[model samples]
Target: MRTSPRAHARVALAAGAGLTLALLVPGAAGAATGTPNVPTDLYNAYQPCATDPNAPLVVAGRGSGVTVEGIPRHTSPSAYYLTEQFRYWPVADPTQIATVERTWSTPGYEATADLPGLVDGSTYAWQARTVDPSNGAASDWTASCYVLADDTFPSQPPTVVSPNYPEDRSSQGGAPIHLELGSNGVSDIVGFQYSWNGVFSVSGADIGEHGIPHYNDPFDGPRSAVRADTLGGTASVDLMPPSPSWIQDLYVRSVDRAMNPSPTYHYRFRINVDAPKITKLSNAPYGKPATFKFTPDAGVQAASPVVSYTITRFGSDDPVVLPAEPSGVATTTLSLAPGETMTVSSLSANGWTSQRNWWRDETDTTTTVTSAQFPANTSSPAAPGSFHFAPKTETSQIASYTYAFGWSDAPTTVPAGKKGELDVTWTPPYSGWYYLVVHATTKDGVQLADTYYWFGVN
Candidate 1:
C-alpha cells in the first residue's frame, strides 16, 4: 500500500509525541528531561553596588537599577527563558523574606529589577533562575548574592574636653583624670580609640579592619569598637597613673559604623606626685612654744621649685601659706595643752599638698601661778607673817597641792579645800631673802601650776 505524506507525517508525529511524553514522565523515561536546567553564574553586577572602602557604608535611598545576570538554561534550546528572583531582608535576619520577580524573553541572560523600598544601610540577598516555556518546567534557583546599600560617612570628629586641666601634671594619686568626648556633627559614633605615648601624629593606618586605629602598648591594647547608642551623647574615659611621672602626650580618635575615623586629637601634660614632709623637733617644755620643721619631698623638687608652703592645723582645714625658706626647712611655733595633738601639712607652689604629719606637745609640767600673797619685801627680826592667798582655780585636772618654805622643810600637803589660805608658823632661816612657794601637780605627776612670794629679813 502507498502511504500519503500527510498520513506518514501523522504516524511519525504520534510516535514522537509518545516518546516525548514517556521521557517527561518520572518512571517511564531514560532520563527525566522536561524540567529546565538550573540557572548558573548568577550575580548582582550593579544594583546594590559593591562596597567601596572609601564610600559611606549606608546609602540614603532605596536601591534601584539592580542588574542581575545569569545563564538561562532549558532542555530545548528554543524554550530558554529566565526568571530573576530577588529576595531581601535585613542582613541581621533572613528568615522573613520579601520578594520581587522579573521575566526575560527566550535566550535572554540578564534582567534589571528594582528593590522598590529597602532600608538604608541594609544588606539583602538575590538570585535568578531559568524556565522552559515549552513544557512549563522551571529550573532550580541560582546561588544567592548579597549587596549593601549604604552611602553616608560621619561628617565631624568627636570633640574631646577635660575639666581636669593640665592633665599631664595632675598625678593619678590626686584624682582620676576625667575626659569627655562630644559627638559633634556625627549622627552615629560607634566608639573611640585612644593612646598615651611620647609621640603625636595625625596620620596612621586604620588599626582595625573597620578603619579604627590601634592603641598600641605602653598604653592598654586596642579596644573593640562599641555601639554608638551605647555611648550616648558623650563618651568618657578615666585615666589614672599609679605614681608620679611626666605624662608626655595623649592621643584619641572617634569612629562610626561606616568605619570612618575622625582626625586624631592630642594633649600634653607633666605629672607631679611628690608632697611635702613634716618633721617634729624636740618637745617644747610646758608654756614654751612647740616647734615643727617642714621639708619638701624629693618629687616636689624634681617637678618644680617650692615657691611657698601651706601649713594646716590638725583640727582645722584652713591652710596657712608661708614663703619657702632658703633651706627647704620651715619652722612653726605652737603652744598646746598637755596631751593635746597638732597636725600640719605642706602645700607646694604648684598647689600639690603633702600628707599631714602630726606632733603632740609634751605632757605639761610647771604649773601656772595666777596669784600669790605673803609678807612684805622687808620683815622685822621676828618670824615672817603667816602666808595667805586665794587658791587659783585649776585649769587642768589637779591631783594634789604642796607648800614649801625656802627649800628648808620637806613639801607639806595643803589639803584640797585649804587652798583658800595657809598658816605658816615656821620661822625663816637667817636669810636676806626668803621665798614661800606653792605647787600643784596633775594625776600623771606633771607639775601643772605654781606661785611664789618673796620676803627679806634684815
Candidate 2:
C-alpha cells in the first residue's frame, strides 16, 4: 500500500529519532529480538560523502567538482534507492550552506555534485545525507570534508636574477648561470611553465585533464615544469651551449592550480668566446710613440659593442688601455723599442675579453756607412789628404755626419748633399800619430756607423 505524505513524514521523523536512540542505547534495537541482531549497515544509511579528497588539487575557475559515494543503511536491496542530499558551505561559517544539490538513481550509490560560482583560493566544507524514497526514512548527516580552492593565478611574473639578467656576454667556459625567481605575494602557485626560445600565451583549445587550458606553443617540445607552493625561488641552468656561437633566449611564466598563467618574463644573451683581432701596429720612429689598431671579432661585434682595448708589450707586465670609438676602431699609443713584441686584445662592454694578437715593432734608425777614407800613414807637417764618407744605404735616415781630426778638437759638420766628405789641411804640432774619425747619425739623433783613420808624424 502506498503511504500518504503525512505518514511518510512521520515515519522519517521516527526513524531519525530511533537512530539517535540506538546510539545512546547500544543494544536496545537488538534486545527485542532476544539476540544481538545489530544492524551492520546502519552507518551506511547515514549519508553519502567524499572519502578524503584534497581540495587544493582542484582547479578553481575550471568548473571542477568532486564525487560523493553512498553508504548502505540496511541489508535490504530496496534501501539502495534512497535519495542523496549534498550541501557545501565555506569553512569560515559552516552553519550556512552556500549551495544544496540533490540526486537519485535506481541504485543511488553515489552523486557527483557541481560546485558553481566558487571563489578562487577559498576553503569550503561539504556533507551529505540519505532519505528513503519508500517511507521517507532519513539518515544523519555525514562528517564534513574540508577542501581548499586554488584557482587564482599568481599576480606577477617571475623575475629573473642570474646570468647578470637582461643582458649578458661571456666566454664559453663561464660558470653555469643560476636562474632565480620570486613570488608575487601569491602563495597558491602550483608550478611554473617555461620555454627556452619563446614566450608563454594562453591557448583556447589545449585543455588539461583538470579542465584547465594550457599555454600554446610551449616550445619545440613539452614545457618544463617546476613544482612548488611558492614560485619565487632559484634554479641552476646551463646557459652556455656546447658551441660559443649558440645564443639563447629564455621565457618563464608561473601557473596556478587552475592552470592560469602569469605574464612571461624574458632574458637574452650570447657567448662570445673568440677574442678581437689586432689589425695593424703602426711603426714608430726611435723617439716617437707607436699606434696599435684593432678590430673586434665578428661574433663579438654582433653580440655587443666593443668598449675598450688592451695593448701589452712583451717583457712588460703593464698594459695600455684604449677606448672603442665610433669608428669601431680602437687605437693606443705605445712608445716601443725597435723589434719589441706587442700584443693587442679587445674588451666588450659586458666585460668579455678576446684573444690577443702579437706583432713586432718594425721601426729602424740605423745608418749604414759604406766607406771612409783618409791617409793611412803620413809624416809630420804633411798636408792632410782628402777625407770621404759614403753611406751604403738609407741615406735619408742620416741626420748629420761629422769629421774629426783628434779627440780634443770639435768635429766639423758635413752637409747631407756633400756625400759626407770633408777636405782638410792640418799640420801636426808634434804628433807621433794623428787620428781622424767620421761619425754618422740618423734623422732621429740615433748614432750609426763610425769610421777611424790614422797618420804618423816625425
Candidate 3:
C-alpha cells in the first residue's frame, strides 16, 4: 500500500534495527522511497486575468497550441535529481488528452510542456506533479487549472459614430473629432482596434534568433487597442486625421478576450479646414485697379477643387463673387481706396468656404516736395545753408508745409508762397547727423504722405 514520506519515516524510527533497509530499499516494491515535492507557480499564455486564479483561460482559436510551465518545489535530500509530469484533459470527456514528462536538472527547477490538442469551444483542465527519477516515486497531483477555449470573434464590429463629423459628407478638418464606440450586443468584446486611412495590421514584434529579443527590437505589436468597460464594452477616443483637407476612411474592429478580431467597419468622411491662399500684388497702388490672385489651398485642391472666390472689401458689405479657372485659381482687378482693407475666400466644389485671407494696399502716391540746397543730403555746421522746398509741378496747390527739424522737437506750420514754394534758414546747434520731416497739405485740408529728409552736419 502507498504511504506518505512522514508515515514511512515514523515506521523507520520505530524499528531501529531495520533503519538500513528502509533507507536502502528505494528500488524494491512497496518500498518507502520519498515522493518528490509538488510543482508550483504554473504559467501559460492562455491564462487570462492572471491576478485572479479562479479566472478561466481564453485561447485565440481552435487547434491552437499553448506552452505550460511550472517550478518544481525542492524536496528533502537535495542531491536527488527530479523530473516533472504534466497531464491535460477536456472537462467534457473523461479520457486523458495527453501526458508529458520533462527532466529539468537545471538549478531553477523549471519544467515546460506543450499542449497541442486544444479545440474550439472546449474547456480544458491541467495539472502537474514532481517525480523522483531513481525510484519512480511521485508527488500528489496538483489542483486542476481550468481554461475556456474560444474561437469565435465578437458577433459584430464595434459601432462607431462621430458627432462633429457626418458619414459621407465634408466637414471642417484640422481639429479633433469625437468618436463613440460601442459593442452591438456582443458582450464578449473587451477592447477596440482602429487605424486611420483604413490601414490595419495585426503583426507582432519580429522574433530574433533563439527566440530572444534583440537589443533594438520593438517591444510589442505594430497595432494598438483601446480598452472598454468590462461589462458594457463601450469607449470613446478623439481622432484627428492629417491636417490640410483629408478625405479618408477610419477603420475600426472589435477585439474579444481571446484577442480575436471582428470584421472591419469603415467610417468614411471628408474634411475641409484650410484657409484659401491669397497672392495679391505687393504694394498695390492706392485708388487704382490692381490684380489680386486667389487660389485654393493644397489640401482643398486635392480633395475638393475651388470653384470660385469671394472678395469682400472693407467698409462695403457687398462681396464680389468671381468664378475660378480650371486650375482652381481666380484673379480680379479692383480699386482699393486709401486706408482700406480686403479679405478673400475660396469656395470648393463641395460647397465648403475656407477661412478668409486678409489683404491691404500700402502704396504711397501723395504730392512730394523736393529740397534744392540739400540735394546732396549733407551739410556742415560752419556753412549753414538755407533749406529750399519746391513742388514738382507748377499746378501744385499746396497751401502750407509742416516741418520738424529734430525727432524730439515739435512741428512748426508755415504758409507756402503763391508759387507753391518755401524757404527756411536753420543754424545747427551741434555737429551731428539730423533728420527733417515735412508734410504738405492742400487747400482742401487733405494731408499728403510725409517726406523724410536726412542731412549730416560735420
TM-score of each: 0.28, 0.35, 0.46
lDDT of 1 by residue, 226-337 (tens): 2344532567776643333444466766665434466767766655535566665755544446676777766555444566666655577676777777555677776565
lDDT of 2 by residue, 277-322 (tens): 6644654445457676687777666556778878777888888788
Query: What overall lDDT, based on C-alpha atoms, would model 3 receive against the true structure?
Result: 0.63
Candidate 3 segments whose C-alpha is farther than 4 A from its true place: 1-36, 46-54, 73-82, 93-97, 103-110, 132-135, 197-223, 230-232, 242-245, 275-458
Clashes of each: 15, 8, 0
The ten-residue window of minimal lDDT in model 2 covers 35-44
lDDT at position 295, candidate 1 = 79
How much is the lDDT of residue 121 in candidate 2?
Answer: 63
Residue 388's lDDT in candidate 2: 46
If ranked by TM-score, best first, what sequence of candidates would result?
Answer: 3, 2, 1
lDDT of all the models against the reference? Answer: 0.50, 0.51, 0.63
Query: Cα deviation of 6 in candidate 1 (Å)?
Result: 78
Choose 1 or 3, whichever is better by TM-score: 3
